[model samples]
Target: MKFLLTSGGISNDSIRNALVDLLGKPISESSALYIPTALYANPNGPAMAARLIRGETNTAPFPDGFTSMCELGWKSLGVLELTALPSIDEKCWLPLVKETDALLVEGGDPLYLCYWMRQSGLADLLPELGRETVYVGLSAGSMVMAPSIGEDFVGWKPPTGGDRTLGLVDFAMCPHLDHHDMPDNSMANAEKWAAGMPVPAYLIDDQTAIQVVDGVVDVISEGHWKLFTQE
Candidate 1:
């Protein structure tokens, strides 16, 4: 599966272009699934989830250039709540996933998202997805793709009790770098966070995103980003 791991949602033209390239079609012509399960694990999660699904943008305290994932105007957009999948039959949702052009996962808690992805069977099903299917992730959604989110980003602990994630990609990420809303995400802190990571890591602002296709990784940014490799 193709990956468009982003610090923010589709916030800039470059990121949008990368997403379209991954889709191999226009956004208006494609179908997508919005996975907002991660949001539920955050503070005021339910309210935030509602706003995100409703495509409400420019809300206060969300950083200057925050973008909503669902407002992109797709041919069709459906919500695939990972938390709800476990209670339902796989046959009912697996086909929906296979048919969608992309999965637009929202930000919240990375570990929480990882936990649900495993429990909902999505983690196990990822490798079987078609190569053309794009996985668009925002913040924690993107972080969950890494081998580990590092201890600093851990919020919701899974039963397994570790910062480990899906490991879909080789590197970990620190999103919203230097954004005033998140003082803890400053570069110095990101550098400290990267120092403890066993793999390479990225420190990206809202305008940046990392694109991975067929195992090749590229930085698609309208703002700034830094890739740190361990010594």
Candidate 2:
């Protein structure tokens, strides 16, 4: 599966273009699944999820001040709540996932999202997806793919201890870098956070994204970002 991991959702033209390249078709022709399970672990999560589904951009938390993921026009968009999947038969949802062009995952709490992904059997299915499927992730959605999120970003802890995540990727990420709303997200704090990480980490602003095709990873950014290797 191809990955379009963003600190913020397709906030700029460059990121959108990269998404199109991944899709190999116009946005209008693509079908996507919006996973808002991560948002439920956050404060006002339900309201935020509603706003995303409705495609409302007003008072959006993103640095770009734009609707993060769900707003983009697509031929079809459906909500695949991870929490609900465990109760249903796999045959009901597995085909939908395999058939979709993309999965648009929202942000909130990475740990919570990670837990549900595992519980819902989605994590195990990821490796089986075809190359044509793009995974578009925003904030926590993107963070969940890393080896770990570090203690600084931990919120809803998993039942099993530790900051470890899916480890789908080799590195960690400190997203929303230097955003005014998140005062603790300064470069200094990011540096300190990276110090405890075993793998390299990317400090990325909202206008930045990490694109992974096969195993080749590339940074796609219109804003500032930095990559810190373990010392």
Worst 10 residues of 1 by lDDT: 55-64
For model 1, the superposed segments whose C-alpha errors exceed 4 Å read 60-63
Q: Model 2 Cα displacement at 155 (Å)? A: 0.7
Prediction 1 TM-score vs. true: 0.98
lDDT of 2 by residue, 67-168 (tens): 557778899999999999999999989999999999999999999999999999999999889999999999999999999999999889888978888988
Measured on C-alpha atoms, candidate 2 has an lDDT of 0.91
> How do the predictions measure up, each by TM-score?
0.98, 0.98
lDDT of 1 by residue, 1-231 (tens): 999999988988999999999999999999999999988888888888888888777562374677787888899999999999999998989999999999999999999999999999999999899998999999999999999999999888888798999999999999999998789999999999999999999999999999998999999999988999999
